[model samples]
Target chain A: MTMLEVLDVSGLVTFQDSGRRGWQSYGVPLSGPMDWFAHRAANSMLNNSTDAVVIEIGLGEAMFRAKRDCVLAVTGTGFEVVNYIWTFPLWTSFYVRAGWRVQVKKISGGNWAYLGVAGGFEAQSMLGSKSTYLRGGLGSAIRAGDILEAGKPARELAKLTARNFPVEKFMNYSQSPVIEVIAGPQQDRFTEEGVQTFYGSEYTLSKSFDRMGYRLELLPSPSSAKGIAQATSADLLSEGMTLGSIQVPDNGQPIVMMADSPATGGYPKIANVIRADLPLLAQCEAGVSKIQFREIMLEEAQENFQKLNKAFKTPKG
Target chain B: MLKPLGDSALLVQLGDEINPALNQRVHALNALLQNPIHGILETVPAYSTLLIHYDPLTLTFDQAAHWVRDKMTQLDDSFHRTPRRLEVPVRYGNASGPDLETVAVSKGISPADVIRIHSEREYTVYMMGFTPGFPYMGTLDERLIMPRIATPRTLVKAGTVAIAASQTGIYPLDSPGGWHLIGWTPLKLFDPTSETPFLFSPGDVVKFIPLESLESNSLLFDQ
Candidate 1:
């Protein structure tokens, strides 16, 4: 069995897979990579299955030594991979010979980055997931002196030249960054002015953002609604929450729930980020990233979703 | 009452307000849905609503909504029968409960009186959320109602007993919290290593016993 020794790890580094599903019934939030598209892309680059465990690096540097020759790729924002002491940016694939040391440097832009080994890193699974939930003390983030096992029996790599995968034709932060949305069940609960403001005005990404939710600072709205508030007074019953659900609590500010959000919340959701644009939201950088919402038909949303999935399924040569 | 929550989920609401009967109904439906039901991916119980999450691939939104309605209609006298009662022990009014005096003053009652009233009444476990193992028990004695602090403390130690909005509960982990601390409990409400991670499930009844009683009898707190 091949293993990688962690020479250094950042404070926020952890192991993430597609996430532990079917456990929300026990009050566990779905803990996984904040950016699913990047996670899958990193896995795909190595020809690993979509759900293979990958290292989720955040805001710090990790130095490791490969015990075996393996193909690897880095995806998501910020951070760069230094192989043989050379820096490679996001979405590129490379091969590292056995015994070569690789270092992931501090994030330069985004909050998270993913490093996927050709044969996925193996770790103890809890509740059928390799992902770590820091809040619950399930799995700790990767640390120095920690050893990680690689998945399964290794196979010989076919003699092949490294090639760049063409960027897919889909929405990302770098592309048409607007997020499409649908009118929510509680959209009517907001004052008519609030609704107009929501669509017409732009919001900046607040500094306070994480896997739980993203708080968007509301711009001064000329048509701001005065007192349109959440209808249900009681704390909402716990229920299935998902990525892109826009929750508005009593404070009048809206929070876009992300992957790790609880199964339920008391805040009334004003809209859901269209499925196609959720990936874009995942890749967005903090700061004054302008946000505007446009309503689209459910059928159109589904079509866009299918298109994105199809692009993801297409193999890169 | 039920409403369309979204294309993929439906909200089966009991009422606009939190009522014990409604909470029990939500829990009953949750238990009923747990046995590998078709099309239902997840059923989550909240303070006043039960959100049924279904797979859009297996069942259409309308079909899932209809299924939930059908299940609710089939529920009868047997569903609302006696719930499991759990006795929890708490050590009140020390570092465990930093806000005990504050809460007592806010309610115009003595700290000792607050403890007596809180311990005497049995509360319902309305839902489990806000954090893992954080039980949202409700129907607290009206005398204990207190507003959440205007400025929420950034950190509240785990097992810190707290009260807010006519409800009483325990913090499962040390996280940023706002609930008024009344006391602390030594029992671990949520341990991921345990076969059953959650100490209290929805529809369960919870009674708080004084820590003095547990110490005197040398009795272990068991659910």
Candidate 2:
């Protein structure tokens, strides 16, 4: 069996796919890649199934050795790749002979990266997914000494250097991002001034951000008596939450829920990140990423999401 | 109330409370939405709202909204279906329950009386959340109802039967909690390898069966 053995793991490295669907009603969060665009870009280059499992490495160094020859691709920002002593750039696919060790150096700008193989990595499936949900104990993250089996490799390995992706033009993780949002179910709960304050001020992502959610620090307003936005009511009955839903607790801080958030939350949601911009927000580095929210109509949000999908669609022969 | 949750999903607030009637309506709508729609990906039903995750490319926000509205008219509120009943055996008091005496003292009743009242009632599953397979069953006997502990424990053993406010549930995983621990069940509430991971689903019925007396000071963990 073709396998990739883990040599050194410095930060969070776990298997991910399109996430566990149809299981949220059972209280299971859809745990998938935080940066969907990066994950898909890697997989699309290989022509692998969109749901194919790939290793999602967080901001740190990781090393692996290939037991058999296979074609591979890596996508996302910040991290240098060295394959068999040959340095390579990001957002492109390459071929490796057996026993070639691949090393990913520590990331500097972005928080997440995706490493996709020709077919996909084999993993223990639970609830119709191979995604590793750390809290749920469904699948395990990649650890030192673990052997990961790879699926069937491609027959042709030519044009490795010729086929390249223009990732710099589309996805830039180094800049401060303004996230577009759609108004929420509890928009009426906030005062008009509170809504204005949310859009008017820029916020910083706090150190306590994780895959569950990102706790944001809202810059204080000069006019408001209180330092933060005030809500008509602090709590609501527990309601269903989606990925990128910005929930505001009584503390007035807006927390954007990610892939592994709780199924239901009691805090009132102020806004939801547009699906198209979710990948951009995902690349925002914790504590260093400054973010702002811009409100848009639902139709515009939907149209933007469609445009993103169209960009990734392969040309029809 | 229908609101756009994000670019890809819509949140339908069926009601504001956690009543059985409201939950039934949520389930009815959930079942109707299960049928094939052009772009409906998945639907998540919570205590009071149903969030539908769909593909924006195939269906617009208005089209999906109108589709749900048409489905809502066909639901029969009077229709009743018998739910699967699960009887869970629990060991009450002593080592199995650290807060049993505290709960009895607050209720102004004897420990045995507290056990009797808790075991006799048939609780209905209001929802499943907080953790995987953790069922939130509710409307305990008024006299037995008590507030959650002021300070939640950092680590409570899995399968520990806990009560907070009017709802009672079992901790499917060994995690921190604030509910009053009255006992523990030996049954596994969540098993990842099982064909059916959860022993109970929303709209199911549950009954607690008190096991025979055990030697004092003997913890359930010991067994």
Candidate 3:
């Protein structure tokens, strides 16, 4: 089934899936959806395979026109969805009539939104994934006036009607989230006070944020302006870095490594935000979203991660 | 020390500095577990650490840590396998290398002396990072060591052979890089179509051979 012609794209829209895996050893980053839960949720609502390629839209407004009638689901945090003058709620499947226009506008509370067709968007898959890595010139790049083709939907538009998922059950983006984290590999490199401050202090997501990292700033305060101090000033021997790894460089603020973070880094990591709260951190509006960090034990973090996976589990009928 | 990284992977830290001994142990552990444990997914070996990605659903953090810790105890420290030796051909000076004169002038050496100093040493592929298939080779001759340029160029063409403090590397793909560009290589470091995409692997020994002219390997750039 072929549909969805891109009309206008003010934001960066690219095709993404579960990400390219098993290539990190060669210095390749696992480029995928910034909001892992939202991507899977959109696909599940349409009974699409969990690994289906969805369009990741970031930076604000975009417009798409359907070439033919198709079943579509849009999920993310606080994005307004409209077909003509009629608005539609997110996290639910909707039938788009042929030649109708769909407009997605960012109202507030998030930086990314996912558009998953029932059959999933067909895109250029390189190195075992359709996830777009623009820097590496790897996957599909969607621009204004491009034609998007998709595979056959498991069921026609009629069967996907009325299927809706409550986003609040999995994530509540409205509130300033108290994100959970675990100790990182270089946790010992931070001062005792630094560890305490990282967990206690409120941080604002800086504008210097991207798929590589989300640099966090110590929320301005009367006394705690120096930020998280370090035990050592030396950079660590460059080593493998993982997603959510919170590296506190010489400046003392933290940079949360994200989906497209390099395979390795040299900065001293203070702590790592748990996998469960990464989506929440990724969605935070840069410079606008206030964030807090709460340290959790490894077992607790494991349970939290599993809970998120369960919510995003696939093959829905 | 085996430490948990968030809830997805474990960081096996072998040492605190960049040394061949530490890199050997890193690659040793990687070789031992070429076929990963039941729940482990992939292993990424770096200068002094190895990151093992795992499935959180199948293996709990403790279970994965326990399995790797057992292997660490039995890790072979002795250098058993002979490293692979390969030569990378480079076109130095002139249009192929825009910064050759500046680099030579900065180091108070002729361009030929700089090339001779850079290509003589057989550097070890310490790790692959910065970009895909971009090897972080080390033991750069002290005479040629230069810190990265203050202002990085917006577009450093792919296959640009460059150097930074104590290291020499190739730009596998066109990227914005700050490294001091000393030469250019017709060889593609990253070939996604090949059986082995990356030209250099950790634990391999690489030597750079300067290309006096390109007529010898015109077919290389064709691919």
Candidate 4:
């Protein structure tokens, strides 16, 4: 059996697929790659199934020992994959011989990185997905000494040609980028001034953030304009929350829900990052990056989303 | 009220009020839309809203909105199904409920009276969220209504039955919580290994049955 043995791993590295759907009604969140664009790109490089399981490493390092010759790809930033003596570039696939020690170094820029096998990795599927919901303890994180089996290759031979990927589309780590967002359903919960402050001001991601969501602090301003003001009735009947939904608690600070956010929440949501820009938001490393939100019409958001999907549709080398 | 939740999902809210009528409408729409529609993905039923996720490429927002409006007009309000009533055996004091005496003192009622009142009513499962298999059931007696703890405990044991405001819920997993703990059920609300991971859905009926002693209730906590 083709296997990759985990010699060492850092941070929260876990197996992930497209995520679990149809189970939200049972209170399960869609826990998958924070940067989906990177996840898909890595899978596409190896020609794995679009929803195949990959290792999602967050700001940490991982070392793997290949048991058999295999083609693999790594995407996202802040880390480099080293095979004993040779260093592999990001956003490209490479063939590793048996007994090669592949190690992902510590992330210096971005918070998330994805590593995908040619035929995907074998994982225990819970509720139709291999995605690990860490809070629920559904699937498990990769631990040292764990044997990760790679699926049988669909194609026997690997294509030696390494093609370039449009990094700007889905790859941005440690850069301060203006994220695009659509006004959330409960935008009215914020006053007009609050809305203006939200769109006009810059925010820094707090250190106390994880896969569930990011807590942001308002940047210092010259004017008396501070954080946004929340409505008196801040609590709502709990409703289903989507990824990128920015919820404002009584504290008035916005918390953008991530891939592992609760399926439903009671806080008032002021905005949601557009699907096209979620990758950009996900790449904004906590405690290292700052962000600003740019409001966009739903039509513009939809058009951008289509463009992103189209980029992935084109045949890769 | 219909609102777009990002590009992939649309949320149809019946009303924000926690009442049977609003929940029924949400449940009715969810029940009707359970079957797969062209390009439509999964549907999640919350307390008073049905969130529908769909592929934007196959179906535009306008098309999905129009389809939902059309579907709403044909909703069967009289449609009814017998809800499965789950009897949860609960231990009301000691380690099961750390705040039982505190809650009684706050309400100016005896601990035994608190248990009697809590166990007497059948709570409707309004929704499930916060964590996997955590059921948010509601409409507690106004007299027993109390605010959540000022500072939430870092870790609340799984199966802890807690109350706050007008709602009663059980923490399916061991999680941090702010609710006033009153009791705990021996039954597992969630089991990932089981075929049906969740013990209760949005519309299920749950009746808390107080136990004299949890030591004898070995069948409930088989784990």
* Local distance difference test, each candidate: 0.74, 0.81, 0.85, 0.84
Q: Can you tell me the CAPRI class of model 4?
A: medium
- Residue-level lDDT tens digits of model 2 in B176-223: 899999999999888989898888787788999887644343523443
The reply for model 1, stretches above 4 Å from the true place, is A9-11, A78-80, A85-89, A105-110, A153-155, A159-167, A219-240, A311-317, B1-8, B37-39, B76-78, B220-223
Q: Which stretches of candidate 3 lie over 4 Å from their true place?
A: A312-317, B193-195, B213-223
| TM-score, one value per model | 0.88, 0.94, 0.95, 0.95
Point out where model 4 deviates above 4 Å. Answer: A160-163, A169-174, A223-225, A314-317, B213-223
Q: Tell me the tens digit of each residue's lDDT in model 4 across A47-117.
A: 77889999998967899998888888888887888987889898888888889899988656678889888
Question: Could you give the candidate ranking by lDDT, starting with the highest?
Answer: 3, 4, 2, 1
User: Under CAPRI classification, how is model 3 graded?
Assistant: medium
CA error at residue A2 for candidate 1, angstroms: 3.9
Interface root mean square deviation for model 1, in Å? 2.5
State the lDDT of candidate 4 residue by residue for B53-158, as single tens digits.
8887788888889988888887766776566789898888778888899989999999998898888999888888888998888789887899989999999999
TM-score of chain A of each: 0.88, 0.93, 0.96, 0.95
Q: DockQ, in order, for the candidates? A: 0.38, 0.72, 0.78, 0.73
Judged by whole-model lDDT over C-alpha atoms, candidate 2 comes out at 0.81
Instruction: State which candidate has the highest DockQ.
Output: 3
